[model samples]
Target: MGNCCGTVIEKAGEMGKITLEILGGGEEIGRLSVLVSRNNSGILLDCGINFDENGNPQMPLYVPPKRVKAIALTHAHLDHTGAVPLYFVSSKIPTYMTKATKDVLRPLMEDYLHISGYYLPFEYEEIAKLFKNTKTVKYGEQVEINGYTLEFINAGHIPGSMSVIVNVSDKRVLFTGDLNLAETELVYPANYREEAKDIDFLVIETTYATTEHPRREDVEKRFIEAVKEVVENNGIVLVPAFSVSRSQEILVVLRKYGIDVPVYYDGMVREINRIFLSNKAFLKNHGLLRKAIKDFIEIRGWQDRKAILESGGPAVIVASSGMLRGGPSSYFLRKIYDREENGIFLVSFQAPNTPGRLIVERGIFEEGMVERIRARVEWFDFSSHAGRTELLKAIDDLRSSLEKVILVHGEPDVQRKFAEEISEKYGLNVIIAKNGDKIVI
Candidate 1:
């Protein structure tokens, strides 16, 4: 659990056995990376890049590059696979992911580096090299590499996202990388079958462990009502969503309800949508996406973006950056801040210190420029992570076989609190991991 930059020292020497290490996703929500090592071979779960001020890569974890044998990217989210190219650029490791993740991530990563204007950590040629090194794995198929057997399960977080199950010798570990038990119109629900009963270690995400989200049906009803209310009032509704899963989910919801309002896709959401379309086979409800693409959705161009502000009577505009950092959402917020007729609906998880949280919680937008924006602000907690109750349920579901539980992807306080809750509630051995912490199985 030490914060040093070297191999974690284990008590009683190296167990000369299989072990799991927390490379990232320890005390934070993003930048999820973990190493599962047995003997001398290692398999990385994810290689995500954290976003810094200005939306550039802030890679803090170091993996010695060469020590990594292969990578299993859980999804295409930047926080899950953004830093993958960095591995290819720096080292020679074969990466594996669902075909959908690769298709979606190829453009997203490049677009991120393009818009940020920061010197890209990896060049385009390097990305091609990374692509060549990547091998696509289908769900449920087990692949053996470097003495470890790996299987990918549907994570339910996003299209093509997966939870990695690793088998090494006699030990088995399941890494639930950003799981969502709730079903969505865009994707199938998670598969937490009885077959997973044999897992020895369950590495779970505690991102929303302190809260419980509304039922999916209730959420959909509220979302439809909110959009309808804004439209009836002749006001513009601005939805700030993540460019990947959240954006696609919102679009599907809008399409499902027969909302004829002009839906403008702006910022990276449009590009990400294109990628989603490209890999339609990975989508859970491909029929719905195809239907929406054919009938309801309208892709916006740069000039068309201004139309959302100027022309409009009752329109639904979904844009990113979801956190309101520096995307079309920020520009739209600044434009509509002073207008009482406008409504801002937050449909994603807003991290601490992000602008989206500030706008919803405080209603304070920037330092006074004379007038205060009094638009009605409402939040719908449609987070992709499992909630507190769901986390406990997941733990209980696996109790019959799981021996040890390792909590990751949350703040220190939250992880500690959840760890205690797990121990008390299930009488399980829990490990609250910090960065670089390792546990032998």
Candidate 2:
């Protein structure tokens, strides 16, 4: 279980029975991959790239592509779908995801390759080829392949995000890929009502298991107030958001508060939003999205982005490379670091060692200045992941029917903490999955 890769078999002695394996995203927060097999047939969920401590791509130590028959992506987040192209280049398996995910993945992969300035593990041609082989599954439609039935329900984290329910041998396994239970103006809450009746094994994400987030109303209020303060001071408000869910979430928050000051969106977030618009079926509230489209101004090209920064004053700009890695956010940070009047608002979780966390923790500006930016630094807990209370509530809601609970997609300590809470409270079998840990129902 310690190894980062390779095929891990549990209950190997039970020959014809079904089994489950955690290939990635077990004791870590990124690179979500899992394998479910029954009677020689297999389905891979989310072949994603794992980030090293420095937020760079690190290949998994063990991944046997030969056994995989198909890949199903939950969404377009790099942590959830970055390594998908690698599978297309290295293996013969067909990949599955919504059209929106493929639309977002193309430009993101291209950008990744361009920034790294090295030969990508997979080529653009492979991405195209994989798209050709991809089997698009709409939400709520059950597809039966080789005696196994699978269905995807909206996970409410991002556009085209899904929580998968797989049934084999009369047992059901639910794989939640980055879920958000609270409803936002941007997206609707998860559709757990229909799937809650007969869930046997629940594989849930615990990314926010130890914290409590503010209510939607409170979050919008804080965000609007923060923006008002920055705007009144004639300061540029820089929001570092994840390219996918967080960016859209923030946009909805801003619009819901009726802040009509031209909000500019740059980087992959614009492109991703385009994809989301293209795949309207996966979105939670299409009406609200239409309203957002009618109101907001989107920054398209480099020139437009540069002009926005050069002429910045009292406008809300939502730009990505959320962690401030290499996108317009970094460039904007560099430009606005000297201004005491500007404010940088971090609305998403910052992974360790990333530029976003650095800016939040140590307010060092460019050229090694050790002074905090004169502008106010604010954090609003508007995360897409379910917070501690929501997590407990979700578990409590499923307590009677849920037999096995496997915690994944979080740090080891976080998983352990949540697992302990579930065990002590519900008396259910709570398993904190490690990388390569295999569990059987």
Candidate 3:
């Protein structure tokens, strides 16, 4: 791995006030990159890529790498880390993320390159170079870059997710990466530390600001019961879940609750599970995780997948792409979707305009669609992000020290309403970040 192979202009841009320039993920939920600058030092919060209207992945517009000491990665999600390898390929800017994040990210980037024809402009060599420059920092570790200190706090959305804290020029700025307030069976909820009590500038994620998620246990129980019903009727239960923590969480929940039916998993879930198990230090219960992995049958070969689908129902099958964005999950659904006894369990959030959302909302896959999937469709809220009440409580808990509030990583309408409500409740005005907008605090 050529860890160091690029050059970038270095400068600590003017001093005094802290500045944050948004490159992406201000108006939308993806491609999260923000430049934090104070005095002569600056760093990127997250450089990610989002999808276009035509269903293609698109990176944020290029920004000069000058004055950026390093890129502080908060997690391994594509929406948070997609642009890293290519954007930094020519610059080789040091990238920082949790050790667990690095482990998961390697596989994600490799998979992305293999599947994406040209979405990722960088080659495999560039991914290796990005890895070489990437430095893994543990949660709560302080990283110093050009007279500034950066710290990572557990974000609880997925394995290795962290909220970023920057300390510079006697001021502290907190950037909440994708936030999770409820502890899942896989990971603990975001930890609100005493250090997080007082903040000069607060950059937070309001992903579910307007929506309230059901209790974690309740959601799991309902989903498991629905699966049990389909299984008892000799129908297959197809659960489309994210290959990361979502797939693992569904597996653990089913097995721990004594669901005896055979459960099978396909797609990248198996590989990601291996990575998650090897890094049990970041999980909630090591024993439970191991048992969950052992409990499920891993499906790797297409022949095996077809065999499982042909075997006919009475079992639970979990696959990737919670939204029907093309993965083994869609195949599983197509196989058993015609039967009224069979069911498609949506155990995760279905992004707007995605196949999953269409099925849930419209009950049809639309023109040129694969089968109508007339089977029963059920939705379960297994979201890992904080909800409206929780978000308000968290903000209120630290309001006494909150000087400036900025919201990111959410839909424009959802965040705008929440921002107005937050400003009224706390009497501190809220700022909504837009693409290319810069706020000086």
Candidate 4:
């Protein structure tokens, strides 16, 4: 009904009772964790972490580790899996995720610790234990743990990302863990119609519930055109993208659109690309990525970085921390910002207060030193989340069996607007969740 933090919102029913506790990611976009329980045992959905304005790691609300029977990870993104190692400090409960997710998580976890270890509770030992307890599951595989049956289906957000269906006591609850219904060069569109059938409850993400993205083809075309223009004019183009999937997605887009220029990738993107290449089944077309890799040069060390920057000819560099918080992208920006010929093409969401947002909105970069940038900067909506149209369509497809909708992982204003529309159009009960809220269905 509202942002019910530390409160229980229960539907009175004598049979088929299931309880959901929101430990985090209730009214936020990150640090998502949820506990779903039937009877006395519970399953932890995601053990993630959030960042404070000063870039400190903020963990989710605590759920006693003993009460949780198992942990299910939707993907390997830091916001979804960063706090998972903390659970391993005391509990070795089995963690289930896709094989690709497991493989991709190691480098990310290592990097996260290298950056935020001082503020974290767990260490590398716990991370090792976390992996020791991990059990990989493929798409559509149903595995029973304690009293819950979990089924993982492709989420289409990134490679190996999934939506989880928890079945217990004859009730079905679907958790849309950062899903995307839009098709991309990396993964196929998430077709959840078949899996949504007979789902009694839907716990959905509203990351982009208030907006609709432009057609993928149109966006791709425009992005390619802009890149080609920069390359042809003997200028440098830097694309700061997420290391997980966005960086690789952009490379595939460049190849698909026939943008033949010197391409160099820096930061942790090279590691993520290797993980994606080895896990070929999780991708839409791994061959395209392989081909792209053959053409692009990897910035192995400072020597390679300097070589690319010192080159006279035009080149495109793709790097990580899409928001330009702190990565090789930031270093590259400092070198190229004063040049009018260079361009910064941001292909991911720029959260408020990040360097990427500042450049886009105010044409400035303010990390160590504030500088008025002269480089042409543009942002593309290469989000891997379902937009308003896709979200409503998902609800319409599952409306027959959906009784209650609980929205999470969006700003408060966006969730409120989305909740109102769902309530009016579908005439279904909708709840805008906050941290520490429990719901019964």
Best-to-worst order by TM-score is: 4, 3, 1, 2
Distance from true position, residue 334, model 4, in Å?
0.6
Regions of candidate 2 where Cα sits further than 4 Å from its true position? 1-14, 61-63, 117-120, 300-306, 309-312, 365-367
In candidate 1, where is summed lDDT lowest over 10 consecutive residues?
Answer: 1-10
TM-score of each: 0.92, 0.91, 0.94, 0.96
Per-residue CA lDDT of model 1 for 91-168, tens digit only, reads 667888888888878887777767766676777777777788889988788998878889888888888888889988
| Number of the top TM-score candidate | 4
Error of 4 at 104 (Å): 0.8
lDDT pick, better of 1 and 4:
4
Q: Write the per-residue lDDT of candidate 2 for residues 117-169, one digit (tens) a residue.
A: 54457777777777878877777878777677788888878777788888877
In model 3, what lDDT does residue 279 have?
82
By summed lDDT, which 10 consecutive residues of candidate 3 come out lowest? 1-10
Q: Write the per-residue lDDT of candidate 4 for residues 30-65, one digit (tens) a residue.
A: 988888876545888988887887788888987678
Candidate 2 clash pair list: 5-62, 6-62
The sequence of per-residue lDDT tens digits that candidate 3 reaches over residues 79-176 is: 98888776565777888998889999989888887988564577888888888899988877888888788988888899889988888787788898
**By summed lDDT, which 10 consecutive residues of candidate 2 come out lowest?**
1-10
